[model samples]
Target chain A: MREPISIWCFSGVLLFIYGLLIFASGLWELAHPLLHPPVLHQLHAPIWWGAILTVIGLWYLIEFWPHKRASQPKE
Target chain B: MFPATNLWMVSHLAGMVAHPQSGLIAAITPSGMVRLSPVDLIIIAVYFVLVVFIGFYLKESSNTGEDFFMAGRQMTAWIAGLSFVSANLGSLELMGWAGSAYQYGILATHWYWIGAIPAMLFLGIVMMPFYYISKVNSVPGYLQLRYGPATRALSGITFAVMTILMSGINMYAMALVMKVVLGWDLNFSIWVSAITVAAYVALGGLRSAIYNEVLQFLLIWAGSLLVPILGLIEVGGWRNLEKQIIHNVGQTGYLHMWTTLGHFNTNPMGVNWFGIVFGLGFVVSFGYWTTDFLVVQRVLSADNLRSARMAPILGAAFKMMVPFIVILPGLLALSVLPFKLVAQDIAVQTGQHSFNEVLPLMLVRYCGPGLLGLGVTALIAGFMSGMAGNVSAFSTVWTYDLYGAFMNKKASDEHYVKMGRWCTLIGVLVSIGTAYLVQHAASIMDYVQALFSFFIAPLFGTVLLGMLWRRATAAGGFWGLLSGTLTSFGLWEWVERDPSALRYVALSPDAKAMAQDIFRALWAWVVCVIVTVVVSLLTKPRPVAELEGLVYGVSPIPEEHDDHWYQRPMVWAGVVFAVFVVLNVIFR
Candidate 1:
């Protein structure tokens, strides 16, 4: 029997995906700014926020990864 | 263009000034909508895919009735704890309370703090043991064990009806928000979210709903944490924000929680300390936190008695921090937004934004493309999770308390499991029907919310008495609950018929609508207790042997063998309560 996936892993995967997309978008905006950027556009919030999400996602993914040898439940 | 009734209803319920006839044509104009980029769409699409995948993955484990309805009772403290709190953290609540903070200042923080923390702690430390030991599947089941079948049936029927209607309100509110914030069509928003929530909850049952709720909790923080952070940075720091708010509003009382609460007229909320303490803190908070099956079901999914006890404590700790995300944005809007947010009627007439738009407006001010998508996804997740919570609880109560108890007593486990899934779909359909009803009438939303509030305080009185006092007879319980609910409804009607009756209900002419609500709950609870005590004294009591596990003193609590002091539920609850006190004091 296959082990059940932890919610943390699912969260980590989604956060990582979101972080990558947001980071890329942030970099793109930095290169070519929009016609009417929002307030504090100079802060590059998406880049930092995305990076923070990425690091936290990586940590959760590594910490809660399912063990290959076990079929028992994992918290 | 949206109907004037729809905009009026949404804006009115969202705590903006309601003028149903005045803003009919210009309400929610298309030019004001925020268009989502392709990147934003992808983020939302990803969320839908992931939730559906979770439902599919957990399908095999959810075959039995126990597993389907209660997640096989295998959730950890953190998972159950987060789901417990997240169940209440809906987008409507987020948007409405943020608007409340903007309109009423820091006084709105009371709802998250004193109004919630102590009740939640009481649930964890005092109530959880009986709930866990009784081995009941739902709150109604516990009532049946403690009181009688009549009390259980009454509560079960009311709860089942209330949950479904509330789910519909959530659905309609979400669609209305989507129409006002984005350019999304109302039907599209309603159908898509309803289908997604229905599909996942039906496929995976409670486990799917719980997991999604946990994920939604994180998504809410990820999406909304930016608003306060950026707003603070923009306006310098908390000190400077306070100064800016004082300069803007011309009053320093908006920053204090308790000081202005001495007199109703002194505070922006127009609620005094007495109402805040007994009405909100004791009655309304306890009613909602301790007895509401939607949240109690999450705690009941805990793997053990210890985990069950710890879950709400953990939830309370996190709950104390929620005002930072919910209330701070509104305060920031008061200080930092370049344009003044008028009432809904004026905003529609003048093409300016209203107070309820603070959260979305703040999101637009700070977030660009990809970040905007995350924020929007968070709101969607919050809404869908709320629907799922209501639907899932509705299914459980319907199957176990109503159908299984009354209709088919000899059904097999497989039969009940099948019934549960079918009920989930049916519940969603009914909720969708209700959403359309609200979309048409709009005034039904107010009545539906009032209907929900009618049950909670009196139900708490009944449940608390049942659990604590061995002499609380079944007849007493039934009459008390019925009278309490009827009293609440009667009070609401009286106030509706004569607006001046607010002074009688709320105890002061200076008291506002919020104070009236709080006082109404308090009075209903007091009436319930008085009636229950009077009736129980006359009625014959249940035998102590039958009340062993249901009543407090009669039941023998199992000693928790914790390896460490920190693992004790009492220790954590104490720590949480101390912090809660400090927060109230600091804010006061």
Candidate 2:
């Protein structure tokens, strides 16, 4: 059987990278205060944003992986 | 992070905004550079890489003419819906509207809500079945099926030219933003954007463009979400933002949407409810949302009739949130950014600068380095997506509608696909020249909206009457369209020749170009409907048997009853309408 090409594969990878960037930016903002100030003077906002993005990314990965794997060739 | 950098930017922005005559500063000093931090660079790099990756990934999927032009009719509702809105949420929208917000205040939100929501809902519920079930490849093809070949040719050629011109304007706007915010060279910026859009669109065709649009949509949200959130917090929430705006501008009307629209003199839009309702809402908005191929092409790519119907509805839902990010930032800039000009004489000596840089200025003031990079990337993504949307639509229409219809008459699928690719490249190159021509306009957004009134308003009148009224004949469609377009041009020329002439029509004396645009659309639309009806009555109409699925009552409705009640198009449209009412009431 041909492998099913899910739109999720494309959307998932893009979201995952975006999530990781937001997470890293939050960590960087926390670590280097003078270089990158907390956006709008709230330290917690970035952290929360990071967590939300990370979860969205993980959700795409977890939900779509089985369908993707099931359609792959056994070899 | 850098207090010194912040101080420098604030002082420079103050110099620019104090004078109203100059456009953007001719050149930024070395200190004005918005350098991306390592983290920010990485984020932007990843964004570009992903865009290229998606284009290449979808290349193989577009093997045939159908796949290349229409995505092989395999798009889900969510993907098509997101792409539909993303194609619209381009640089012209983000930057142009933010500047408009700064200049016109929250009245600009009407363009997003009442100006858009109803028409989008109408498209999904009433028009999608005709478009989807008929299986016409392009909107012009539908015209051909409904009216005749002549109507299709007129509309198709005009649409092709307009789409390319729109793409060029988008490219020009994007380059202008980059030059202002990042101090990038203007020509360099234009060429880079032009090349990038042409590359991906030519390779992956409509599917690649749609996929990238979905990706860009997410980035736009993520990048722009912070502006309102942080802006509200800084300004002490929505009430405070309202307070600050009133304090800054000395007007309570700026905060309320529909309340001030009772009279032309009361609102910043400088037009009354009649113009907003009958002109923008009924004519301009409906014309753009319902008939513009830039957006309809996305819906046409849907996998099923249900998906096609749901696409615009989903887009309408997302369209509601746009003003929050794009407009609120402009309002926020009024409170935060400085407007103390260099000096009256110095402004004369040094050249005055406009506040068109409102969004970029706010970004500099609010966002830190990493987040700043992401935000800038979002702006670039928006511009490219918009250009790509225009380019892809242009190629499809040019290849299928004009080239295939008249030039070749009978060509293989492979031959047409090659022609589409060539058209895509030529379209982008021509757009680069069109970009240069856009410099004559006073404001980018106003220029774009004016183009809509001139071209699209009349087109909408003809299409709307043709779709619902089967009595509309081919001669009526052609002559009605021709007269309406000519009427719009004459109105514009008359108004330009004598500024006082509009007062005779009951428009305000001091009304800006935008208000004139509204009235112009109204006149053209009226002319179109009257002419179409009169001509159709005098001419022989096509037989009812021939109309079939192309007309409203001539054919059986597609099998959509098996779906759940909640999933019905009417149900979704009702929900959208309810939300639209609640929003207007609250804002009013």
Candidate 3:
């Protein structure tokens, strides 16, 4: 029987996807600044925030990878 | 008058401005406000797809009634713990409390701290054993075991109705927020979110709801954490923020939690320490945290007695940190926002921003496209997860306590599972109906929310007595719960008819509407305890043998065999309590 998927694995993938998108958008904004950027736009919050999310997502993915072995569903 | 009445006026005014029927949507130009870019839209779309995928992924495992309703009782403490807290972390609460913080200052933090932490620890260490060992499917199921079918039925019906109605109110509130913040259509937001929540909850049952709640918890942090971080950085540090607030508001009282709480008139909330402790901390908080089935259902999904007990303690730890994301933004808004935020009515009339817009305003102030989308998605996720929690709990109680217990006792497991699924759909539909009803009348929203206060305090009194005291009779439990609920309702009516009655109910003419709510819960609980003791002594008690697992003294609690001291619920609860005291002291 196939092993049940865990919530951590799902969260990992979604966070990675969102982080990558946000990171790319943050880089693009840095290159081509808007007419009126947000208050703390100079801080490039998106880049750092995206990096943090990516790191956390990657850590979750590696730690909670759904291997073929029979395992309890640990969320 | 009442806070709910104030909310109704706000919601009604927002509805009038946003409703398509009023032709004001075009005039208001919601698109003129914070508009989501393609990146933001993609982020939101991705969230929706993932949640639905999770629903379909968990469908196979949810075939059985136990699996569907209880996640097969196989959740880890972290999963159950996060879900437990996240279930209560609704968008309405996030936004409303942020507004409250803006309006009431640091005093608002009491709801997340004193009003929550101790009660949560009590639930984990004291009450969880009775709930976990009794092997009940729902809170009403426990009532059936402890009291009788009559008490169970009354509790179950009220819970089921209140849950469904509250779900609808949440739905409407979310749509209202989306309209006010993002220029989304009311029906569009309502139908889309309702359909998604209904589909996922129906497909995956409790497991789906629980998993989504965990995910929502993370998303909320991911989305909103930037606000305080950026705001603090912008306005220097915490000390500077305090200076800015004092400079802005012309008072240091807004920054102190306990000092200003000595007198009702000293604090922005117009509530005193006595009300804060006995009324909110003891009665309201315990009632909601310990007995409200919406949260308890999550803890009940824990795999073992140890995990079940640890879940709320873990939740309390995380809950203590929530004010950073929720309340701090409001304080930041008070200091940093360029314009003053008026009351909802004043905002509507004068085209000024209202207090409720603080969170979104802060998000917009700090976040551009990609980040803006994340924040909006977090709000949407909070709303959807809250709706899912309500629908899932409603289905379980409706199927098990109401239908299975009363209507068809001999139904097969498969039949009940099918009924549970149907109940989810029905509950969502009913919620949708209630949303439309609120959009039309708006006043009904106030009354529906008031329904929660009526039952929760008295129910807690009954449940606590039933679990602790062996002599608490079935008749005593039923009468106590009924009278407590009626007393709360009667008090609410009295205050509604005569506004000056707040002086009597809240123990001070100076006490505001918020204080009235706290004292009302306290009085209702007192009335319940007195009536319960009188009736229980007069009525014959159940044999100790029959009450073994249900009552504390008669029942033998299962010993938690932890491998280390760190794993003990008591040690961690003690740690959490110590931190709780320090936080109160620091904030005081």
State which candidate has the highest TM-score.
3
Candidate 3 local lDDT, B1-588, one digit each (tens) = 112433543474464354333322333353535778899999999999999999999999999999999999999999999999999887777888888899989888999998899999999999999999999999999999999999999999999999998888888888887877777888999999999998899999999999999999999999999999999999999999999999999999889999888888988899999999999899999999999999999999999999999999999999999999999999999999888887766665666777777787899889998999999999999889989998999999999999999999999999999999999999999999998988888778668768888999999999999999999999999999999999999999999999999999998989998898899999999999999989999999998999988998889998778899987999999999999999998889
Question: What is the per-residue lDDT of model 2 for residues A1-75, given as tens digits with 9 covering 90 to 100?
Answer: 434445666667766776677677777767767454534746455566767777887788777653423454778
Ranked candidates, highest lDDT first:
3, 1, 2
For each candidate, give its TM-score against the true structure: 0.96, 0.91, 0.96
Ranking by TM-score: 3, 1, 2
Q: Which residue segments of model 1 deviate by more than 4 Å? A: A71-75, B1-32
Residues B405-459 of candidate 1 have per-residue lDDT tens digits of 9999999999999999999999999999998997777778778778878899999
Q: Rate the local accuracy (lDDT) of all candidates.
A: 0.88, 0.77, 0.89
Candidate 1 lDDT, tens digit per residue, A1-75? 435789999999888888888888899999989876878999999999999988888888887777665555877
Residues B1-588, model 2: lDDT tens digits: 001111222233333333423433443344233656787778777877777777776788888999999988899999999998888887556766776677778888888898889889999998888888889888898888888889899989988987887787677766666655666666887898888788888888999899889878887887888877777777888877777778888988777888888787888778888888888788888888888888999999999998999999999999988888888998887776657223224554566434456776667666776667778888888888888998999999999889988899788999999999899999999999877765443244344444545778898998888889999999999889889988988887788779787874436675665677778888898898999999999999999988898888887877876457898877887898899899889988
**How far does residue B572 in candidate 3 sit from its true spot (Å)?**
0.4
Chain B TM-score, model 2, reads 0.91
Off by over 4 Å in 3: A70-75, B1-32
